[model samples]
Target chain A: MSSIHEITLMLNGDPVEAAVAAHTLLVDFLRDSHALRGVKRSCDMQVCGACTVLVDGRPVSSCTMLAVDADGASVVTIEGLGGPDGLDPVQEAFLEHGALQCGFCTPGFILATKALLATNPSPSREEIVHHLSGNICRCTGYQKIIEAVESLAR
Target chain B: MLPRPFTYHRPTSLDEAVTLMARHVDDVSPYAGGTELLLAMKMHFADYEHLVDLKRISELRAVKRNGGTLSIGALATHAAIAADAAIQGSLPALAGLCGSIANARVRAAGTIGGNLCFAEPRADPPVLLAALDAQLCLISARGERHVAASQFITGALETVRAPDEILLRIDIPLTARSTRYERVVHGHRTVAGAAAVIAQDAHAAPRVWLGCVATHPVALPNAEAHVAANPGVLDNALTQAIASDIARLDIADDEDASADYRRHLATTVAIRAITATVEQEERA
Candidate 1:
């Protein structure tokens, strides 16, 4: 039988609580329950990084993670990155470099970049490529994305 | 797609986790990073009525060096293993391999225990761990037992671990003076992988294992014998030895690669791995 878990976690710096079913995936929880549609669901198999999210400062495949697993952890969705004032630096970099043609993959790429920059503030070109390898983007051929992230590298 | 509904048990201790597993035996699975298990469940390939989440068991995440052995807790994530100072100091090659497994997200979420337990034919850790002569400690309500990494995996997605048992940790002795792991990746998955190790005592026979080219990691006895016979050689004879050994394995054509192509790739990696170890030995 399915069980309901009452989970309390920090979402995008805000404390939130919910009752999630055992089988509810984190991607569905964010998009459906919280209406955070910025986290897209393309490849539910974890191969595609379209459903990427930061759990405790590390990038994880939200499509494969259960919502209940996020209890007591801090999760950051794409919606959590920017504010009403302005876009996140990673998003701004993408905009300036024309890194996106279709924006379906932008959020995942940006968040993955954010996670990379968190641990390695100045990742080399190879490091950036390696870190974002999981996040696939069919549009723009990834040149602009690499350039955008490279510009941010110190 | 969402997995079929099941009861989730979050056990804070290893004993609690095993107790839950024993109680639910045939219907339960001990959940780790869920990188493989959840994906399989979503695809409707495998389903369990109960899942005992082992994340909260802190003891299962430790990575420490105890004298001559490196003890890696079962729940240690690939990222954790890669960044660990103990593993880096004792077996930097393993740390490097862990860093490159799958991708960044997978590295952050997938654990070595989960990888071994799932026993995916294309997985990376098994071949390298087997070559290192690592030991796995499994615990159950009845008792605990130790098994060699080389014999832990029986086949693809198959292991000797009983349903009521939980893999506690992996203990690797720091006896190898030089080690190298080489693989050919078609995409994110490895098409073929080879690991070679030369023990600190020069007289000991070299260990060589091939993975991702078969159902489980297979010891390349002929390749090991070649390395043993020719201590510091990377010649055509060595290549022939690896090729001949690979030819004997029963490989099948799959969508990723053909049998002949896999054999070729396996030989290339095996030779490269042995050559790398030899080069490292010379440098030392």
Candidate 2:
């Protein structure tokens, strides 16, 4: 095998560079290298959406993407969604509707909703369910989350 | 956990990527959206010394229409396909499948080519592509070639793509046939164990592709022929034939489901999908 390489890309609205092992996952790079621990890693497999982030404005499971594959691409983590002063609409809706319980899966779900609503501001109930089906939440049942998103549509 | 150490190269062009793959042979693997490839690497199921990242290749990200057919770039993410109104209009089934794939987050990053090339029996797009007779464009250091979806998958986690080849695009022929998809999942608790059926009724023999019941997506020729020969007798003969055939397939083992259960689900889902397709055609 060859040695690890250094790569640079726009991350969370900032141009960042990091030297990582060729096999390093984007999730690890965000959490460890760049210290953007806002993107949590749950299952680490593509099955769970806890590691969801936007790659060029599209929500993608960061755990399934290689750090090198993200080179030259624009990425947005949960931190980029909002800051200490305020929150994105989806985040606010999540909080207002009590869509989270453990909050482990909140970031992934919020990002997924953000991506969905960006293109579809008025998604039907079925559309909301289908869109968020990939992000599994073990707590607080998806009813409240769906309610929150539905409320947002209103 | 992170994947084993390896060298990564981002090729700016398809030609460069193919050349890198040709030079490295089996030691090199292509990384598209890396949804499946990266996960496989993390699980230690693939041990390649070098990864040729195709993200930098601009040509592979296009979603264009050539004449009546829709040519979706291999690198086009599921989100892109779902959001494209052209795909939604020309291939509604394809768009619906893209929208329903895994989740919004995964779909945002996962590519259609990656899904098909992964050769997972349960993957969504392959079944729909096979039923629609989608053409896969392959490129390599040598040249380009086109293969039908049914001919692309050789077996479980396997494909006809050579070591030096990259799947360039998926060309879906524009047709007036109405299509429908039915997926039977045990309620989304686990990742595996889902049966999907895609069918088109306008052709002489309505095409049906069954997923999650075999090593690769299976085209139900017997059921299709049964429907074509006796369109009136579809309910009984088609269902029986598909059920028996699915019962006999050798599906890969997974934690989410057993071989027998997947077979049963496949037959059940195929019946529903076939009926739904017929009803949809009637409504149209």
In terms of docking quality, model 1 is: high
Compute DockQ for each candidate against the true complex: 0.88, 0.69
- In the range B228-254, model 2's lDDT, one tens digit per residue, is 676535566677888766666667657
Q: Find the candidate with the highest DockQ and give its number.
A: 1
Candidate 1 lDDT tens digits, B1-284: 78999999999988888889999997999999999999999988989999999999999999989999999999999999998887888899999999999988999999999999999999999999999999999999998999999999999899999998899999999999999999999878899999999999978889999999989999999889989998998889888888888888889999899999999999999988998998999899
- Compare the candidates by TM-score and give the number of the best one: 1
TM-score, B chain alone, candidates in order = 0.99, 0.91
Which parts of model 1 are misplaced by more than 4 Å? Answer: none
Worst 10 residues of 2 chain A by lDDT: A1-10
Reference-based lDDT, each prediction:
0.93, 0.78
Model 1 chain B: lowest-lDDT 10 consecutive positions: B238-247
Q: Please list all clashing residue pairs in model 2, or write none if there are none.
A: none
- lDDT of residue B119 for candidate 1: 95
